[model samples]
Target: MPDEVRELAGVPVLVCDPDGPLVATEQDALDLIGAAFLGAQVVAVPANRLPEGFFSLGTRFAGDVMQKFVNYRLRLAVIGDISERLARSPALRALVHESNRADHVWFLPDLDALDARLRAAS
Candidate 1:
């Protein structure tokens, strides 16, 4: 992560546009988020360029991330066009539906909406 990215942490929201294997490594992921809320009230990560297996690893990795966020009480919004995943996994669809009902984790379709939601939450 760069200094600019760390600066984002101080803002009210953090929109991430990562590339390659950054999302695959937990340290990289956390580092990217370390400064997302620099001094703001809330943060949101728009995972547009996440590596493969992030959602597919829903049973494992997703669950782990979700738990970590929940434990830290950090709100996260997964912004992506996840229609395919939703169609393939009924369980994932159910989880999305359930998560959407909460303020912490949201599976949104676009970044604008994600920003709006996070801004509203903050």
Candidate 2:
């Protein structure tokens, strides 16, 4: 399936396919933002769609990609379980925790969680 937009808790979200193109570069992240610009207020990217470097804080790839979304005023929800990765890196765990506490970025376990969050926000 391709990346498509869906309404979750009254918010239009661009839900990316789990098997879609890898978001390993800044340009790739920008493309997603552009796609969401059509109508989505949020972009929900599957964890598998991201490169390994994104989960590694030392690489700073995740930070850069997240900054792009924030710059564009779009909420980003990274969907899928990342417990393994989180266990491997404390910095990443902290990042996820902090991101989830804000409205701009979120690391969710699934679409259901994203729906719940949006519902609460509304």
Candidate 3:
């Protein structure tokens, strides 16, 4: 599926579906950012759309990916419950929890939750 731009509470967001290309790296994220003029402040992508490396702390892919978004001043919402991954790694679970607590990144169960959070932030 193709990525689309959506608006929530006056903010334009880029919503990437699970069937879309994998966003595994900073460069891939930059490509998504490039799709819009001036870029989007927030992006909603399925958890499965991310690369496997993103779930492994030893790989540092999660940190790198998050840093990339931070550098661009963009917030990311990774949707879906990664229960299996969280169960396998305490570190990953902590990271997810911490990211969710921050304003810059969030891990949501669905688009409706993302929309609700965005609405509350506005």
* TM-score winner: 2
Q: Which residue runs does candidate 3 get wrong by more than 4 Å? A: 36-39
Kindly provide the TM-score of model 1 when superposed on the true structure, using C-alpha atoms: 0.73
Kindly list the per-residue Cα lDDT of model 3 for residues 5-118, writing each as its tens digit. 888777888888789889877889788767744557788889999988988899988888888778778888889988999999999989988998889999889888988998
TM-scores for candidates 1 onward, in order: 0.73, 0.98, 0.91
Error of 1 at 103 (Å): 1.3
lDDT of 2: 0.96
* TM-score-based ranking: 2, 3, 1
* lDDT, candidate 1, 1-122, per-residue tens: 43233222233545565343346655655654565546433344545555556677554777777666666666666777888877888878888899999877888887677656655655
The sequence of per-residue lDDT tens digits that candidate 2 reaches over residues 56-100 is 999999999999999999999999999999999999999999999
> Once model 2 is optimally superposed onto the true structure by TM-score, how far is the C-alpha of residue 46 displaced, in angstroms?
0.2
The total number of steric clashes, by the backbone 3 Å criterion, in model 2 comes to 0
Ranking by lDDT: 2, 3, 1
User: By TM-score, is 2 or 3 better?
Assistant: 2
Task: Show pairs that collide, candidate 1.
Answer: 9-35, 9-36, 9-37, 9-38, 10-38, 10-39
Worst ten in a row by lDDT for model 2: 17-26
* Candidate 3 or 1, higher TM-score: 3
Off by over 4 Å in 1: 1-11, 18-21, 40-43, 57-59, 118-122
